[model samples]
Structures are given as structure tokens and as C-alpha cells.
Target: MSTKKISIGSKPTAKPVQPSADEWVEHRGNGNGPEPMKRLTIDIPESLHRTIKAQCAMRGTKIADEVRELLLQKYVKS
Candidate 1:
């Protein structure tokens, strides 16, 4: 049996893809109006995540929708 040599070197780095301002806005816009939805990334404890998932399952809603509602209720003015 012939043994093959494996390359254990680091791979070349790729340039990051950056979105243009107009493209970014258009992509994120809701299309109803100028309401753009921004993506948010957050870290939460496993327990909290489980709780959110359970609540969403019970309500038959999405975690994002539930989180958005909660945020609006707490932050947005009536």
C-alpha cells in the first residue's frame, strides 16, 4: 500500500465580503416602508435559551417574534 503525504500548513486567508451601503439598506428593508431590520447577535445562558424556546413552543410563535415583542414592550413608547 502506498502512503499519501498530507499538507499540514495553514490555508490562505480570504478577503471579507463587504456589502455596499445601498445594498445593505435595500436588503434589510421590510419593503412596506423605510423600516430596516438590523441583525442583532447576542449571547445568552443555556438555561435562558431553553426557557425562551419552551415559551415560544407553548405560544406557537417564533423566538425572534417573542423577543421582538418583549423588546418593543420594554423600550418602545406607546
Candidate 2:
């Protein structure tokens, strides 16, 4: 579902060359001021998510933002 180029028999096959940033934005939202970040609805087991939600609430942030922050800090900080 994501872009990763591949070579095919002495030729490169790129996935419909990416549009420029502004063009991508315009195309995605159909000229309606760009769409918000795509939201995903997942079904995680409550047992695991309960602790996750509690920590997010304690830190006063959305679960997505909190998770992103924690992951970036933990994984990308090295």
C-alpha cells in the first residue's frame, strides 16, 4: 500500500510517479482544504488498551499523539 520502487528487466517501475506536495494535497482533499490526518479504527483487546489509555490520560494527550511521541522518543532517539 506504500510506495517502494522496483526494477523490472533493465527498467525501473515507479508507482505512478508521486505528485508534488501541493498537488498531492489538492488531489487528496479534492480542493477542500486538505483532509485531516487519516484516522484508523482498530479493535485492540481492552486488556492491553486500558493501560495505554490510562497513561495517555495521565499525560493529557490523544492516544495516537502519545503513542507517536513515545515511539519516536524510544526508537529514534538513539
Error of 1 at 39 (Å): 0.6
TM-score of predicted model 1? 0.56
Model 1, 1-78: lDDT tens digits are: 999999898887997989999988677665678765688889999999999899889989999998898899999998
Best by lDDT: 1
lDDT of 2 at 22: 90
Ten residues in sequence with the least summed lDDT for candidate 2: 31-40
Model 1 gets an lDDT of: 0.88
Instruction: List per-candidate RMSD values in Å.
Output: 12.0, 17.3
User: How would you encode candidate 2's per-residue C-alpha lDDT over 19-64 as one tens digit per residue?
Assistant: 8999886777665685466565779899889989898789888999
